[model samples]
Target: MATEQKILIIEDDTFINRIYKRVFSLSGFGIELAQNGEEAMAKMESMNPAPTLIILDIMIPKISGFEVLKRLKGDVRWQKIPVIVMTNLSEKTDEEKALNLGASLYLVKSDHNPREVVLKAKELIDKQIV
Candidate 1:
């Protein structure tokens, strides 16, 4: 079913954002891009339907992704949304921290390509639908 589901991508690298936008777009997902936590918060505030999924990078300028994630999970409006923390932070502690902060999943950037990330996101979204 093609719903109005969209994906919000929070990444500092323009190149990575482009790649993700292309892949997710090809897969029929609407994409919103934010370069940092501040932009992300602003985007979230202005968004109408609220994104179904958020892909976040933990190490961004202005504000950290952990802080963003915490705010998202704490807010009643966005609390139920699923977040995927996709970063190069490969430390087990980092993954644990993301999960502890209520991320639905944590991914190491080098470990998954854009298409794979899309697949994982689709899977997570499907689970939410069920």
Candidate 2:
């Protein structure tokens, strides 16, 4: 069997993080979690094989997800990693900022269920492989 793709979920909410972990794990993707932007950056830096996708939350502690996205897209080594901005903020400006900062997709948490998020992640990862 082919190895499962890894997904890094940067969310500060314990409940939401657990949901993502369970859903992705059940969907056969390897999972990593970061509760805040600082930890997310540290994890990304240390991971040998980078994650296939990143599900980021904008309201994270320490640094905002926008800053994280900016830094990731700025670094050549990590720039190509697909980032899906998932957060409670549903404003057009926030969405635009994320996309402008190089996020692959922006999703409002209330609009998407865990299954849908997992499916989207899979689709994005598949596209990357192609």
Candidate topping lDDT: 1
- Superposed model 1: Cα runs more than 4 Å off: 1-3
**Clash totals for all models, in order?**
0, 0
Cα-based RMSD of candidate 1: 1.0
lDDT tens string, model 2, 1-130? Answer: 2766888999999989999999999988888999988999999998868888999999999998999999999999999899999999999999999999999999999898889988888888779889
The whole-model lDDT of each prediction reads: 0.93, 0.91
Q: Mark the 10 consecutive residues where model 2 has the least summed lDDT.
A: 1-10
Q: What is the lDDT of candidate 2?
A: 0.91
Question: CA shift at 45, candidate 2, in angstroms?
Answer: 0.9
TM-score of each: 0.96, 0.96
Off by over 4 Å in 2: none
